[model samples]
Target chain A: MMNCKEATQLLSEKLDRPLDTKEKVMLGVHTAMCSSCKQFGRQMEDIRSLAKQYSKGKQTEEKK
Target chain B: MIEANPSLSASEAPNAALFYDQEFMESLRSQMVKFATLQVQDAQLAEDAVQEAMLSAYQNIDKFGRQAALKTWVFSILKNKLIDLLRKEKRTTVASQLENGPNLQGDALMDHLFKENGHWQKSERPQKWDDPDHGVENEHFWRVFDACLTALPEKYGRFFMMREFLEMATPEICHNEDISVSSLNVTLYRARLRLRECLEDNWYQAKESGS
Candidate 1:
C-alpha cells in the first residue's frame, strides 16, 4: 500500500501532469483507505484554484 | 508591436479609457509589481522590470486595441521582462544549490510531517478546510494567502511562482532552471504541503476560533 507521503506526493504531481496507470491505481488504493490523504488531495486542488484566482488579480478590496 | 484583433468587435473589447483612469492604473501597477517581485525576488529589480514593461505598454497603447484584455497584454509584457531579468540574474543555480544544501536533507519539513513509516504525524494530518471557495473570495483570506506564499523558503517560492503564477509548463521550467523533473516535482510538492499547512493554521483555524 502506498503510504501517506507517497500518496500525497502523487497528489501534488497530479496537478502538474497526468498520472500513469500504475500511479493512478496506487493513489486510488491509498486515498480510498486514508481519510487524511483524501483530505490532503482535496486541499491541494483547492490551493491550485486559489492560486489561479490570485494570478488573475481576483480580490475583493478596492485598495491594497 | 501590439496588434488589434479584427475578430473582436468594438463593444467586446475592454474600454481603452480605463488605461487613463488613475485608480485603474494604480491597481494594475500594484498587481504587476507583486507578481514581478515574487518572481525576481528583488524589490529594486522588480520595480525596474515593472516600470520598463509599463513604459513599453504606454508607448504601444495606441496599437493595443482589441488584441487582448488590457491586463493580459500588460502582463505578457511583464512576463518577458521577468524572463530577461531572471536570465541575467542566474537565479536557477542558486535554487538548485539550495536544493542540495546539507540542511535540506531531502526536505526537513517532509520528515516533520511524515513519520518513519510514511504515515502522517498524528498532529500533522490535514483537517477539513471549511468553505475554501468562500475563503478565496474574502479579502482577508487573500492577505493570509499572500502571507503564506511569501513565508515560503525563497527557492521554493520562486519555482512555485514560475509554475503556478507565471503558468509555465513543467518541462519548460525544468529546462529553464536546468533541474531534473524529479527535483522540480519534489520542490513543488514541498511547497504545496507547506502552503496548505500555513493557511490552515493561520487562516481557517483563526476564523473558527474568532467566530
Candidate 2:
C-alpha cells in the first residue's frame, strides 16, 4: 500500500505530465482505495487548475 | 485645466498601451514599489529594488519568455530582485536583521507543515477548486484570487506567485531556490489551497445573494 507521502508526490508531478505505467498503476490503485488519498488527489488537481488562473492575464490582482 | 477626477476613470481604456509606454512603465513601477514596501517595510530600499526590476525588464524586453504572460514575467523579476535586496540588506547593514534575519514568523517551515506524534498536519485545509458551473467566463474571479494572495505571508506569497503566476516549472523553481523538488511541490500545494479557500468564500457570498 502506498503511503500518503508517496502518493502526494506522484500526484504533484502528474500535474505537469503523465506518470510511468508502473507509477500510474501504483498511484491509481492507491488513490482508488484510500478515500483520504483520493480527496488529496482531487485537491492537487484542483490546485493545478486554479494555479493556471494566475498564469492568465488577470485584469486585476487577487489579494491574498 | 485638463485635470480630471480620479474617480472619473479613463474614457476608453487602451489595454494594449500597457505593453510599452512611459505611463505603463510607471504603473508597473508603482505596483512593484508598493508590494516591495509591504514585504521589506523600507520605502527607500523597496524603491531601489523596484527600480532594478523595472529597468532590467525594460532592458530585456526581447528576452521575455512567452511561457508566462507579461505581467507574470515582470512580477517574477521583481520577486527575485526583492529577495536579493533582502539578502543584501541582511548581510551588510541592518544589524538587527543580521541577528534575527528580519524574520518574525517562527519556524516558517514548521508553521507551513509539521508533524505531531508522527502525523503530518497543516493549519487549514482549503476547499476544492471546481470548473465552475458557469465555467471560466466568470468576470470577477481574479479579484477574489488576488485578495487571498495578499493575505499570505510575504515569503510564501512571493514563492507562490513565481510558481503559479509565472508558470515556473517545479524543477526549475527548486533549482532557482536551491530547494528540494518535494519542498517546492508542497509549497505550491499550500499556496493553491489558500487561494482556493478565499475564492470559495467569495463564490458562496455571490450564491447567497442569488439563491
Candidate 3:
C-alpha cells in the first residue's frame, strides 16, 4: 500500500512525465481510497490552470 | 490615422503603428518589468533588462509583422537579456544563490508536513478548495496566488515559474539549470506542496470563513 507521501510524490511526478503501469495503478488505488490525496490531485490541476492564466497576463488586464 | 492611409506598404504598416501606440507600449512595458523583476529579484536590474529589450524591440519593429504577437516577441527579447545579465554577473550573490541547492528550511517544512511513516500529518493534509475554477476569474484571487508564488524560496519560485509560466519541459529545464532529473523532480514536488499549502491557508480557508 502506497502511503500518502509517496502517493503525493507520484501525483506531482505525473505532471512532468508519464507514470509506469505499476506506479499508475498504485496511485489510482491510493487516491481512490484517500480523499486527501484526491483533493490534492484536483488542486494541482487547478494550480496548473492558474499558472497558465498568470503567464498570459490575465491578472494585469481589466475584466472585459 | 495610419490605418486610414493605404499608400504605405500594407505588410509593414499595422504593427508599426501598434509598436508606436503609447497605451499598448506602456502596458507591455509594465508586464515585462513585472516578469523580469520576479525572475531577477532586483528592481534596478529588471528595469535595465526591460529597457534594453524594449529598445531592441522598437528597433526591430519592422521584423515583427505576422511572425508573433508583439508582446510575445518583446518578452522573448527580455528573457534573453535576463539570461545574459545572469551569466555576466556570474560571481554575484544572486548567481551564487542559484547554484546553491535547496535550503534546509525546505526540508524542515517537508518533515513538518509528512510523518516518519511517509503519511501526511493529519493536520497538514490538503483540504478541498471549493469552486476553484471560479476563483481564477476573481482579481483578488489572483493577487493571493501571486503572493503565494512570491513567497516560495527564490530558486524554487524560479524553477516553478520556468516550468509553469515559461512552459518549459522537464528535461529542458534540467539541461538549462544543470541539475539531475531526480533533483528537478524533487524541487518541483516541494514547490507544488508549499504552494498548495499556502493557497489553502491564505485563500480557500479564508474564503470558507467569509473573512
Candidate 4:
C-alpha cells in the first residue's frame, strides 16, 4: 500500500480519471483519513475553479 | 454546441465541418487563446498564434489524420507557432521570469517553490455552499480561491491552464508535449500538491481572520 504522500501524488491522476479501481479505492480511503491529502484535494479543486473564473473573466473583458 | 451534419452532397468530402464545427470553434476560441497565452507569454502574440493555427487547420482540414483529436492537432499548431514567435523575438525580449510576486529568494531546495509574504493578500474565506434557508451568496470564497492559484509554481501554472482552461485530455496532452505519460502525471501531481498546500494554508488563515 502507498503511504500518504504517495497516495496524495496519485490524487491528481484520480482527478484526471486515469486511475484503476483499486487505486481509486485506496486514494478515496486515504483522503478520507489523511488531513494533508484532504487539504490537497480541496486545493486542486480550488485552483481549477479559480482558473475557470479567470478564463471567463478574461473572456468578458475581451467582449467589452 | 455543434449540430452534427445530417446531409452532404455526393462526392463532397466530409472534411471541413468534420474537422471542426463552427459553433464548437466559437466555444473553443478563448480556450485556444488561453493555451497560446501561457505558451508564448504575451497576450497579443498568443491571440495571433491561435488565429494563425486555426486558419492553418481550416485551410488543410482534409489533411488532418485521425491519429490525434482535432483539439490536439490545433494545439500542436499553436505550440509550433509559439516556438517560432519565441525564436524571432529572442534577441529583443527581456529574460524576466514569470511570477505572481512576493518574491522570495532562497538557496534552500524546498523554499524555492514558495513566496515569503504567504498566499492571500486578503484573508477572507468565502462560503463554499449557498443555502435557501440561510441568507444569500458566498463571494469571499472566490477571492481566496483566486489567490491560491496565483501562488502556485509557474510550470504548474501553464500545465493547469493547458489542461483545465484549454480542456485537453491527458492522452492528447502526453502526445502533444511528446512527454511520457508518467512524466505528465508527475507534473500534474506536483502542480496539484502545490495548489493543495496553498489552499489549506489560506483556508486556515481565512478562519483566523473571520474569527
Distance from true position, residue B53, model 3, in Å? 3.3
- For the second chain of model 4, what is the TM-score against the true structure's chain B? 0.45
Q: Point out where model 3 deviates above 4 Å.
A: A59-64, B1-48, B56-96, B99-105
Best by TM-score: 1
DockQ of each: 0.49, 0.23, 0.50, 0.17
Cα deviation at A49, candidate 3, in Å, is 0.8
Candidate 3 chain B: minimum summed lDDT over ten consecutive residues — where? B90-99
Error of 2 at B5 (Å): 24
lDDT of 4 by residue, A7-49 (tens): 6567677767678888888888876876655655565565565
**Model 2 CA deviation exceeding 4 Å by range:** A3-9, A16-23, A34-43, A59-64, B1-30, B34-130, B133-135, B201-210
Model 1 scores a TM of 0.75
Order the numbered candidates by TM-score, best leading. 1, 3, 2, 4
Error of 2 at B66 (Å): 18
Kindly list the per-residue Cα lDDT of model 3 for residues B25-144, writing each as its tens digit: 789889888888766677999999998898777667677665335676778788778766655553233322663444433668779899999888999999888877668767788789
Residue-level lDDT of model 2, residues B10-125, one tens digit each, is 32333333444567667867877877775456788888877777656545555654522566677768877766664445322221231232332334533443353312354333
Comparing 2 with 3 on TM-score, the higher-scoring candidate is: 3
Model 1 stretches astray by more than 4 angstroms: A59-64, B1-47, B56-77, B83-94, B98-106
The per-residue C-alpha lDDT of model 1 at residue B71 equals 76
**How are the candidates ranked when ordered by DockQ, highest leading?**
3, 1, 2, 4
DockQ, candidate 3, comes to 0.50
